[model samples]
Target: MRCHKLVAYSVSAAAMVTLVAAGDAWEIKSQNKLVKHCANREGYDVCNIVLDISDTHALCSVCRLNRTIPDLAKPENRLRWSKLEQAKRRLLIGLMDLHLPLEAPVRGYSRGLCFDFLEDQRSNSDVAQKFITTGHRDGVITINILEADDVQRVWQREHVGERYRTLLGHMRHEVGHYYFELIVSDREGFGQIFGDVDTAYEKALKNYYARGPLPGWEQSHISAYASAHPAEDWAECFAHYLHMADTLETATAHRLIEQFSEQGDFEQLLLLWDRFSASLNEVNRSLGLSDAYPFVITPIVKNKLRFIHSAIARYVGLQL
Candidate 1:
């Protein structure tokens, strides 16, 4: 939120941050209320939980979107919040690096973005809700804080028979849905490319859980859960697209495939990703860990990724 400079003190940190309020856009306005600089700011020690950029700005762009944070009184919640913030920072960094439309609605974005890190009864016995499904809706992303714990996340991943699951993966997946609503939802060729998102998702979800994904799902979809709905397919592809972009940036920064690093060249990225991911998997195998990237990107799934690449490029006015 834009505000004139003002002083605010941190109770937990026992420190005073100088006058804060500046040009960087992101207001802490929840759906039900406007909460300007109103967070306990309990997430990561380095997540800039208060988003103290300078005397002029109070929050980092990513931390500014937080609508609800877990109870900081609990030492466990503090650690969990830290992990969630790390994943979220990486996710937003990719979005910013890709030049995605990420401004809050107050800054003229079509929708306002916010995050809610909550605890449900399943995870927190005293919480009101029984279960909290991590998802995005109306620009609000709700993440069940339980995902921050490795044992719980891995248990659910195995129970669901998933090849991969991580806090970062969850962030990437849910943010994909947020972008779909903004850039691709009403665009031409989306239906022809991904499929109709207007189908009955609830029914489709029930059927998907009951009978599993379409036979030979990996022949086309990036992940089996993508077969549950058109939105899921698009979201899955979007997540993979982000995976490519972020990984390429990291690989290039480390001078691995530095020669192949070229922004806006989608084909080149795919080629480089294939070479790098294979080596990455091999490196993991050398260490007795699972393959770093498990799923194969079939020709059809590759096209889906290509579409995502093109769509994002078009969104940012980058050709090819």
Candidate 2:
């Protein structure tokens, strides 16, 4: 887990139950017997229920990944942590759906996905630690507790000129680094698909950060940071694929579009996404907001995404 660092939900504000639609063909259990509003996105295969009960913690068997819980010293912090957990679980559900291997020492041998919801002095004056970077290292993903705070997240968003940002996006992007290790670093046949990952990662990263994104970078990358390196490119692409697939399935499940079952299989899913994202963009426009999905999925990128889908299908024992 240390060797690689490529790493790379929803439900509602209050009501305990709601339904999720996965195209027209699939309907996953949205709520557990406890009536916790839930939906399987990426990591649900391993944990029947991704979120913990109101008072307990649940271990993720597939990833064997749980570290520290956020200190809920402040009354509101607990609620924030719970919301963060929900987002984390939803993200893991998507990773599981992809069938990408996990690499955590806790889970032993290629099974690794872990989290630590940590706090700092900013969030809790009593805490000795002053700052915590949200990053992944040695089989663990550590998120600063402040990220769960609305004020902090919004501040960071505006500082970055990003069209979209969220706790789930951070989780997904970091996990993208993790999966890069799993699929590209150590796996064979990856070079054939993703190009050689041997390009100096550290050097590329420095240049990306120093000069900012390439001029007119939209022609090349989905986000400014994506131009950092090939590894980053892969991670960004991985995250985008998950974003696209998850939203499409949810939209389909909600009857926002044609039923997925009637539409057909994975190919149909792609078609649906193409149609749905346009409306999603326009809806955001009407609200004077950035497009929900701003990046264009180029033909080359589409083929790369298909490779990811094929990998997931193989993991699930489906004939791709």
* Candidate 2 least-lDDT 10 residues: 5-14
For candidate 2, write residues 1-320 as lDDT tens digits: 56442111222221223334434322324442222222322323222333433424333242235568765456776677666776876786666545555554422234477888888887778878888878776557788877877788889878876666778877887777776554432244555655567788778777876788868657656777777776676677778878876786567668898675321366676778788899999998999997888778666567666666665555446322
Cα misplacement distance, residue 12 of candidate 2 (Å): 22
Specify the highest-TM-score model's number: 1
- Candidate 1: the clashing residue pairs are 1-26, 1-27, 21-56, 51-59, 51-60
TM-score of 1: 0.82
Model 2 TM-score on a 0 to 1 scale: 0.70
- CA lDDT scores, all candidates in order: 0.76, 0.63
Estimate TM-scores for all models. Answer: 0.82, 0.70
